[model samples]
Target: MTETVTLTVRGMSCGHCVRAVTEAIRAEDPAAEVAVDLAAGTVRAATALPRARVAALVAEEGYAVQD
Candidate 1:
């Protein structure tokens, strides 16, 4: 089943960061819907992947995903 995973991500300061996060998640699930709010420092993604996996993907892009 698919789920929406919302993460509080830090270190996203520009479009590149947003794109990195969005692409990172999309690379995992091409159909995943990703929205990044740089101003709010948050990422909201609709994906089938587990929350931990999503967070890990974000972290891999050099961002901090808060619990």
Candidate 2:
């Protein structure tokens, strides 16, 4: 079953930051659907990807995932 996760992200100062986060998540799970809200600095994804894995992907892109 697909799971949904909402992650609060830090260091997203612009649209580029949103795009980067979106890309990073998609890179890890090609079939995952990702929606990044730049204003809210949150990313919501529908997939089976684990939270820890997602956090790692964001960290790899030099961003922090707020718990």
Candidate 3:
């Protein structure tokens, strides 16, 4: 089953950052539905990927994912 998660991200300063995060999540889960709110520095995704994997992906992109 797909699960939805909202992660509070740090260091997302611009549109590029938002795109990077969105791409990172999609790369981890091709079927994931991702939405990033740049102003809020948050990402909401509906994915089958595990939470730890998601967090790692964000971290790899130099962003911190806050629970």
Best by TM-score: 1
| TM-scores for the candidates | 0.96, 0.85, 0.88
lDDT tens digits by residue: candidate 2, 1-67:
5788888988878877777878988887888898888778788889779978888888788888898
Better of 2 and 3 by TM-score: 3
- TM-score of model number 2: 0.85
Q: Deviation in angstroms for 60 in model 1?
A: 0.3
Model 3: colliding residue pairs: none
Q: What residue runs in model 3 are displaced by over 4 Å at the alpha carbon?
A: none
- What TM-score quantifies how close candidate 3 is to the native fold? 0.88
- Estimate the TM-score for candidate 1: 0.96
- Where model 2 places Cα greater than 4 Å from the true spot, the runs are none
lDDT of each: 0.94, 0.83, 0.86
Q: Write one digit per residue (lDDT tens) for candidate 3, span 1-67.
A: 7999788889989878878888999987889998888789888889998877877888899998887
Whose lDDT is higher: candidate 1's or candidate 2's?
A: 1
lDDT of 1: 0.94
